[model samples]
Target: MVKESKLLPRPEFQRRLVWSRDDKNHFLDSVLRGYPFPEIYFADGDVNLETGEGTQLLVDGLQRVSTLIQYFDGDDNLKLTSAPTYRALNEDEKKAFLQYDVAVRDLGGISKEEIIEVFKRLNATKYSLLDIEINNAVYAGALKTFCEQIAEKDFFRAHNIFNASDYKRMGDLRYVLSLVGTMVQGYFNRDDAFENLLDRYNDEFPMHAEISGRLQNIFDFIEECGFDPKTRAWKKADLFTLLIELDQVLHIRNERLQPSKVLEELTSFYDGVDSSGVNQGSVSSIYYKAALQASNDKINRVRRGAIIGGILLELSESEIREKLRVEGLA
Candidate 1:
C-alpha cells in the first residue's frame, strides 16, 4: 500500500513521528520476538472513481508503521540493538517477518471533522487516565524518562516505597517526579509544577547528574538511619516529608544530620502519632494532622517541613524533653 501510494501514513492532522531510536529498536525487538502490538486505525481518503482505487488516511499508529517501513528497507538510520535486521533473516524468517499480523481498524467514509475528532480523542484523555499517564504520551523526554528510571531504582524497591497499584498506574513515576521536581524548585501544591518542569527539561535535564548524586546520598543516609519499616516514617506521605526535610538540611543548608539522632527522634515522633497523639507537643500534633489531611497542599507541606526541619536541629536536653512531650517525659 505504501509503495502503491494507497495508504497515506501521515495526513495533514497526524502528529509527526516522535519515537526515539531506542523506541524504534524496542518495537522491532517485539516484532522479531513475535509479540503483537496494538491495532492501527485508518479512514477513507480521496477515491479515483475511474480506477476504483482509494487512499486510506492513517489515523493512528504512524510511528509503528513508519518504523516497520524503515526496517524493511534496511534504512541506515534504523539501527537495531537486539533485533536482527530484516536482511539478516533467512528465507523462512524473512517470510515470517513480511507476514507478521498487524491488526488494523478502518473507519470508513468518515468526514474530515470526524477524523479530526477521532485524532483528538485518540491522543487526549480517555478512560479517566491520570495526568501522569497523559503526560507520558506528551513528553517522552529527559525529565520524564529520568523520573521513570528513578522509580525503578533498587532503593525504592528495597524500602517498598511504591505498591503494586503504583507500578500499574505509573503512580511510582508520579511520586518520583514530585520528589525531583520539589528538589529542583521547592515545594509546589500536589503536582502543579510537574508539567512545567517536564516541558522545560524535555530536551535536556541540566541537573541530572547533580540531582542524581544528591538523591543517592539522601537515600543512603536514610538507609543508615535504620528506621523500622513498620513505623509511620515508612508510610508514603511521611516518607515524602522526611526526604524533603533531609534534602533541605543536607543540601540546601549544607549541614550534616546525625543518623542515630534522626532515627531516635523520628521514631519517637511517629510513635506519638500512632498512640492517639497523647503527650505529644502541639507542633508534633499539628504535623500529624497535616499529614492526615490534604497533605499535598502547599500549606500543609510547608507546615510539615518546618516541624521536621526543627527536629533535625541539635537541641538541649531540656528542649528535647519539652518538644516531644508537652505533658512531660514519661
Candidate 2:
C-alpha cells in the first residue's frame, strides 16, 4: 500500500528478477503449507530531502516480493500443490494465506553504506545472482528498457542468440548491451561499456533513443539478410563487428544494399575466419581457428572487428558505397 516506500533496489546496485516458474511455485506452495521463510531485510533510508519523509528501502527479497505481487494481482498464474491458483483457495485457505506473518528485519538508523554492505553479504550465497542481473538492477531507463525490448525480438530467436530463459534472467539484454557498448566505444576492453552507457541514459536521453533506433534498424536488416543462425558468423564477436562495420547500412537517408548478397558475404567471411589464423591458444583450433574466444579480450576484439569490417567493405556495392564511405566503414 505504501507506493512511496515500495521495495527499491539501491539505484544501480540491484539486478533483474531471476526466479523461474518452478521457483515461484515452490515458494507459494511453501507459504501455503505454512513453511517458515527467510526474513526480508529493509533499511530506513533517511528523510527525503525533497519530500521530508523517511522511507523503507528494501535491501533484499526483490524477486520474492515481485513473485507474490504478480500472483495476487492476477498478473501471473502461479500453479500450486494444493490449488491451481490463489483465487481457487477455499475460505479457510484464503484466511490462512492472508494471516501468514512474513518476518521483516528492519535495519533502521543505518547508513546507506551499511545497508548496501548487508545486501552484498546476503546475496553472496550459493544462489548468487549473475553480474549482469546485478548490473540490470542498478539502472532503469531508455537504455535498459531499449536493450530489453531488442533482446526479446524475433531477430535474436532467428539468430539463435538466446532463448526465453536468457531473457528471463536478463542474459539477452546484457548481451545486447555488450554489443551496443562495444559499438559505442569502437573499442572493447577499455571499460564496461554497458555500465558506462547505462549511467548516461538519463542525461543522454535523446542519444539513447538514437542508439536504440539504430539497434532496431540493424536487427531489422539482419532479418532481411537471413544468414544461417548456426554459422560462426553469428557469434557474439563476429556479429558485433559486422554490426559496427555496417552501421551506415541502416540509415534512413543512406543508400541500400543487396540484402541476400550481404548475407552471402557474411557467410563467406566467417568461413574464411574458420579456416584462417594460426594456433594462438584460445583463438586456436582447426574448426574455428580465427574465431576469438567468446570473451571481451582487447586484441581479440580489434582483430575480429578488423577481419569482419574488411569483408563488409569488400561486399558493399556501389549503391551504398557513398554512404559507407562517408561513415568511414568503407
Candidate 3:
C-alpha cells in the first residue's frame, strides 16, 4: 500500500518526522526481534470512484510505518547498530521480517475534521505518563538502546534486580539509565538528570564501549564477592547504592578492592543495618533510616553511598561512624 501510494504515511496536517537515525535503528531492531509495538491508526482519504480505489491517511504511527517502508526498501538512512539490516538477514529471517504482523485500526470514511478529532482523542489522556514513558517516546536513540541492552545482561537477570512492574513500565531501562547516568555524573534525586543524559547521548554515546567494560567489571566483581540472595546488597535500593559506590572506588577513584574483604564488610554492614532497630545513635541505624525513607533523595543517596564506599575502602566501623558524625550525617 505504501509503495503503490494507496496509503499515505504523512498528510500535510501530520507532524514532521523527528526520529533520529538511532531511533530508527532501535525500532528496526525491535521488529527484527519480534517485539510488539503499539498499533497504528488510519482514516479514510480521497476515493477514486471510477477506479474503485481509495487511500488512507496515516493518523498515527507515522514513525513506525515509515521506518518499516524504509527498511523494506533497504534505505541507507536506516543503519543497523544492534540488529541486522534487511539486506544482511538470511532468507528465513527476511521472510519472517516481511511477514511480521502490525496491529492497525482504520476509521472508515471519516471527514477531515473527524480525523483531526480522532487523532487528538487518541493522543489525549487525563492521567500523567511516567518520565520513562515520555523518554521512551521522544528519545529512542543510542543511550536508551544501550540501557535496554544492559538491562538484559545475565547479572541483572540472575540477581532479579527488576520486578514484573518494572518490566511492564520500562522501569528496567530507567534503572540501568540511572546506573550509567550516576556513573558518569554523580547521584541526583530520583531520575532528575535522566532526560538530560538521554538527550545528550542520543546521537552517539562515545563512552559506550568504555562504560560497558567498566559495568561488566563491576558486575563480575559483585558476583565474585558471592553475597547470598538474602543479603540486602541484592535489594534494589541497596544494590543501586553499592554499585554506585563500587564504581566510584574501583573505576573513578582507581582503587583496588578485595572481593573477600568486600564480601565480609558489606555482609556485616548490611546485617548491622538490618538489626540496628531504633538505635538512632549508631551509624547502622542512621544508614538504615536513610535507606528506608525518601531513599532516592540526594541527601539519602549520598548517605548510603558514603557508608558503602567507606566499607569498600576497608574502613573500620568506628572510622566510618566518625566520618559521618563529622559530616553531621550520623
Best by TM-score: 2
* Model 2 misplaced stretches (Cα beyond 4 Å): 2-13, 45-55, 70-76, 81-84, 109-114, 141-154, 157-160, 200-202, 248-257, 271-292, 315-330
Weakest ten-residue segment in model 1 by summed lDDT: 321-330
Report the C-alpha lDDT of model 2 over 125-223, residue by residue, as the tens digit: 755766666556556677777777767777678667775667666777777777767656666663356667888873445656677778777877777
Q: In candidate 3, what are the lDDT values of residues 1-330, reduced to their tens digit?
A: 988998999774454455677988888888999999989998889989999899998987888898898888888877767777788889999999988999999888887767666665665563234677656656768998899999999998898888876775677888899899988888898988988998999999999999999999999999999999999998888999998998899988999889998898889888989998755777788789889999888888888888888888878789988888787777
**What C-alpha lDDT does candidate 3 achieve relative to the native structure?**
0.84
lDDT per model, in order? Answer: 0.81, 0.65, 0.84
Which pairs clash in model 3? none
lDDT of residue 248 for candidate 2: 44
Cα lDDT of model 1 by residue, 6-96, tens digit: 9998775564355777989999998988899999999999999999989999988888999999999999998788788888899998888
TM-score of each: 0.62, 0.73, 0.65
Q: 79, model 2: CA deviation in Å?
A: 3.2
